[model samples]
Target: MRGNRVNPNKPSLYLPCETRNREFEAKLLLACHAAERGWRGVVGAKKAIDQRIARLPRGLYISKSITRRNRFILDIGKRLGHIVTAWDEEGLVFASPEIYRTTKVGATTLTIPEKLFAWGEANATAWRNHPAFNGTPISITGNPRADLLRPELRDYFADEARSLRRHHGDFILINTNFSLVNHFLPGKSLYRQMLQAKKQPISQYGSINGLALHKVKLFQHFIEMAQAVAQRFPWHKLIIRPHPSENLDTWRGIMAGHSNVAIIYSGNVAAWLLATRALIHNGCTTGVESFLLERPAIAYQPVVSEDYDSQLPNTLSLRVSDLNTLYMHIDNLLQGNTSGQETLLKKCHAHACQHIASFDGKSACERILDSLEPTKSLLLDRKKPPLVDQIIGWTAAESRRLFKRTQLVRRTTTDSTGYQQHIFPAVSQSQVETYLQRFSTLLNRFHDLQVDDLGDCIFALSKQ
Candidate 1:
């Protein structure tokens, strides 16, 4: 965050916590890419990121909102000598923070078509440009989710596709689920609610128990659309599958009334798609893979969000609230009217996806695995502030908490159960202040902190 620059003539944005978090996240992304010193660069980047992200709990999921996470960031950043501060001025253009690559990997194919691959490109470049990424072994792996698409794995699903087509008698398949709405919903918050529900004895959705109002509304809209589509195409089977994490029995109990309408078992979503003549989805990247399978697909966007900057080839969205629109598309299909089919569809697919996975799914897995090679990479700074500090700021309790969380700071637990106490590390505090003060004086003396290249510092240090 020390190196961050302020832009003139830009309206400062103090959005809702979640939206502001997104904007901060988008800023400071330039430092995340390091080709060689991956972890080190990443740490340096996050230290800077933390300085900014420390401002918001807006998007932090409540269940995961334990003090431990903030402590974790503080401990890690402190140990790594990462900076923790906020900007004196916020900018209009989104300043992205560099994301820390944890051991967690995106196992689903969703990461690829969702423009995560392109995010890799941008992040990798950030690392390279970062003073931190220099000599780092880390580089972007493209899309880690593509690992399932390699040649060795290609045949794994081929037989399933063949078998499904043989039995289904030319069906139209859709992979539907609440996860399908991941785009519009905040992943950091809503997903945690779902996860928390699964973890705890209770079942809740986004601060509410038993199907959050938003999810209920989502279900209602889908049901109306599905029933309408079923009524129009009496001959076609209407199959719906909720996410694996969901116990759709509740939704199924409601759907039991529709004779033409049906729900799919968890394991069968992919198989059903392979057997189907067409695929229908909403903002799901599976549409790209479905097209590669040579099954034409439909993208349904009942709502749009800001996450669409990265798009794919051969993907088109149809926004509809009811069956009337679906009926029209079905009617067109029945009439052999695949209008604008060739040019817009095929060309867009080719144009949008430059990677081999665009035409062949195999490239995804290969690129992803190759990227996880344990090489060092210096990534851009995604410094986000400690979460609690963002929530409470410099309040007495929060300040005491933040004060104790610092690694270099010593603490004395006076209250134990009541309120833990802290004692600051004079050495660390004085050292930082002294270092900054000297750095500023030196910068004034020399006009900047630069050596000829990596180190013209020996002479400078010796001179001092």
Candidate 2:
């Protein structure tokens, strides 16, 4: 549950959910884990932080996006004497080649939060070398999301997984990341937009890398290959799970009247991973996620290029060049064949260890909390700003809130520009209490922090 309307008096941890996917769950679990350890905080969507920033106290506010808007918010938070932290939800998925170079990337300047919690050593080293983060404080805390994927916590979603198995029965999950192609318009219009992007400056949205143009074709190939596989194995169920950012209607339209092929976009990926016999994808995060769950995955690359191939999960998964190859692997797995799988599995395990942080089924949140112990007194010693400073912070926070409400603020994604919006399912006060109560042993530590319910989309950690 969100913390009671930002109470400046009580110290709390603020975790903003950038997107409602596995990352959201991971962060939520962190908040719950925090509560267990006597920390009080609210987990809300990114917009929720801005809406209630005025009442927010001088404590830590955590975020995931690397956008300018978030950087602006952090700037404002600092002005009001609050600690801000950030981490990439997609940190391990893509390599920003520019981060390797001495010169800063031209796309956008890095927004170095007061504390930047990186996922692993590789990410930490990249940020450490970057010019913008010259003096920024950084900690290589393993991602909390990966903590949930640990085999021990599998019981948390066991009931949901059982329901999924009953509903989808021996299905093959095919995950797609064609959000760039299917989010807004169809192929021709989308291509035109891509051309327009190329003409524009190399901002975050418009890239010279040609990933969008290449992805458009890649999406088409995925669709064609999915259909081919479905046709060949009509007896078996093929579940096509589109990326959350993608347009579900487009996938539904493509697979209309196909009984064996079902396009589903509901439920968390973890449950689906458990329900499936095997997983298939091009180069999406789900491949790595499924790998963590001990599921076999095949990367279908009909048209491959050295420049375009994904290095992490894509390379790690068993690569199948065409539909025939994909069909062969899937058929073999379905029939319970694992004779020649040891070497590839070993490589995937090694890659995950090298790339991802701790996966020992323990709370990474604990490690993060230990890092904040030195600053815990700062949380306790929060002082009210001078009256004039309070007035200025309130005025600025309200102005930003109004600008966002009126759609006056511009938002941009990797390949598009618009007002980005997301809403998390609100948890009730009772629900929050019940969740915290489940981990009562941890809650016994913090005698000062308590949960406060601020009505109408706001909740917080408040001083008891």
Candidate 3:
């Protein structure tokens, strides 16, 4: 019986019962098993990757090499099993076992600069080639978060409005933007305290962007701009919803002098746009969201960053940095000179949006309805159990393989070994180390600073 023999009563099969019925997921389960086996390493590394994959927010995983996340990706797939599919250009590895065009999914802007995405895609070849990834381009559908724009979800928006009605006879909602500097700063804190600061990069080499450094100056600029708006206009109510990931105290401190400003932290962008008549942003993605809803938007600080210039929907930007110009632009928008900007913004909105999110705000809700169809059951039809041991082994192997490859690459490369005498760069390694040391001491004071998430790093900063 052991020598390639099968008992007629129960035959050995490649796939599990679920895969044939579900489509491709059985294969995924096996792949996940393989990955778990493959991720052999010091307990810390495996644990970290495992936790990160599980902790990442629900919605599409938007990495070009999403598969490269390897075990991490598989873990998410397995945990959220049947609820989500691994999306990529091809229907190969981690492809949804059930294929339904109607199932709603949530999506965030998956853009990662073509250069970065391409590099990641090339680096993880094994994950890229998995059978589930064979579909060249699959529609993962629209963002579930956008459901806030739907009439059903608009109640949340209405409540926000009612809160506004009680506070002031008239109000304005100014959505924030993605000025790289502003994105990094805590709005509540910067407004409270005016400070000039610079943070040493985390890595001397490869630290273009990953959320380090405080955006104090930019927030100061924004606070000043907002104050100018209130002083210039007789507006009574103003709700300043900084980005969700901001420190509210910073914004509150800035507005401390004036009692007129209110703060609202919302998880939904579309709902906020609908509740307001006009949108104000310094070229944030919310500008695009606002445009999709046909709301008038004001984009300021036209030259300082890339926000105002992209194909995102934006009514009229001040197009200049002068305070007077900004006031005039705000005045014109409040007075309804919105068409000039609206037409252009609509074009940008339409162009930018059509390619990425083809569905409206109800995309996620609508997508969820398709779970019942047999032909498109997500991954159910695969009728196969994946080779769990192989996948786990592969994951472990890849991790070690990558570490070794990195070590090998580092050994081969030298950064000007012969030129030992040169002027010290303005931003020095020692400076950063000193800064990090101070931060570590700061982080040690907090009980929760133990976690390694981005917020944990910030918590660690507060102690300093």
TM-score list, all predictions: 0.43, 0.83, 0.48
Error of 3 at 234 (Å): 5.2
C-alpha displacement of 50 in model 1, angstroms?
27
Please, what are the lDDT tens digits per residue for candidate 2 over residues 150-199? 76566555667899889777788899977657762344335436655665
How far does residue 439 in candidate 1 sit from its true spot (Å)? 59
lDDT of each prediction vs. the true structure? Answer: 0.35, 0.66, 0.37
**What CA RMSD would you report for each candidate?**
19.2, 4.6, 18.0
Candidate 2 local accuracy as lDDT? 0.66
Per-residue lDDT of model 1, residues 22-82, tens digit only: 1211121111111111211111122223333333221211010112234444333322322
Model 3 TM-score on a 0 to 1 scale: 0.48
- Per-prediction backbone clash count: 58, 8, 70
Better of 1 and 2 by TM-score: 2
